[model samples]
Target: MVAGEPFRMLVDPLATGHCDQWLDLPETSRAGDAAALLDLLFGTDDTLDLVVLRVGTVRHGTASRRLLRGGAKGIDDAAGQTLPGHPRYELIDWRCPVCQTLVWRIHADPRRPPECPEGCGPMGMRRTG
Candidate 1:
């Protein structure tokens, strides 16, 4: 690497650069990272066992599932306890089976998943956390 060398910017924000959208641009930053947001799970969707934890992050981007952490007593259980008295914030997770594409967001009733950029058809819900 050298000074003034071109590089990749992970997320698109109030930013102008070559965006390396290897992952989807983050929707919110102050809303908290995925783990912190897990508090939304409790009492919202009891059937949802999905959990996501952040192993690392930069630029509010990077959605690699391989880097995710927390589950069961880790992120999952803690979610129910943390943010005491906080109301539910329904979230959802969708994955593209063919390309391993992943995404998550605040969910609305009966909204369908977005089409895969890889042209793999509609992504399916893996779960929510």
Candidate 2:
């Protein structure tokens, strides 16, 4: 170890809350709809964080906070819904970064990490996008 050359602290996967898990959905439905998809795919595997990563590009980036309403309804509703609606499940909303466009849909398996559809790179075992 050289003296003060440089020391980049490594972030442990567990410590950083990375390497999360989630159940992708066919569409970007309401929170409720998304949850149902999770239940179906994971079957009670709630140990992982559900991150809606960027699927494609958009003219403007919306905010997650704004998407949610009462008691985190938009986010929590997924726990009690079946499928999402049109606007809610639109690809424009689920933009894919690599493709530089919104994805038609994405349904990741809970048991496995998802791969990049555009093939720009692998969806590494990290939590955050």
lDDT tens digits by residue: candidate 2, 10-84:
111222332222223332233344444433333333332333322122111121212222133333434435443
Estimate the overall C-alpha local distance difference test score of candidate 2: 0.31
Candidate 1 lDDT over 1-129, as tens digits, reads: 221111121111233332222222233332233444434442343543333322113334332222223232234433344454344444556677788765555554244565554578987777732
In candidate 2, which residue ranges exceed 4 Å CA deviation?
1-17, 27-31, 39-43, 49-71, 74-78, 81-129
RMSD of 1: 11.4
**Residue 101 C-alpha lDDT in model 1:** 61
Task: Give me the candidate number with maximum TM-score.
Answer: 1
Cα TM-score per model: 0.34, 0.27
Query: Evaluated with lDDT, which candidate comes out highest?
Result: 1
> What is every candidate's alpha-carbon RMSD to the true fold?
11.4, 15.0
Instruction: Give the poorly placed runs of model 1, Cα more than 4 Å off.
Output: 1-86
**Candidate 2, which ten residues in sequence have the lowest lDDT sum?**
3-12
Q: Evaluate residue 119 in candidate 1 and report its C-alpha lDDT on the 0 to 100 scale.
A: 72
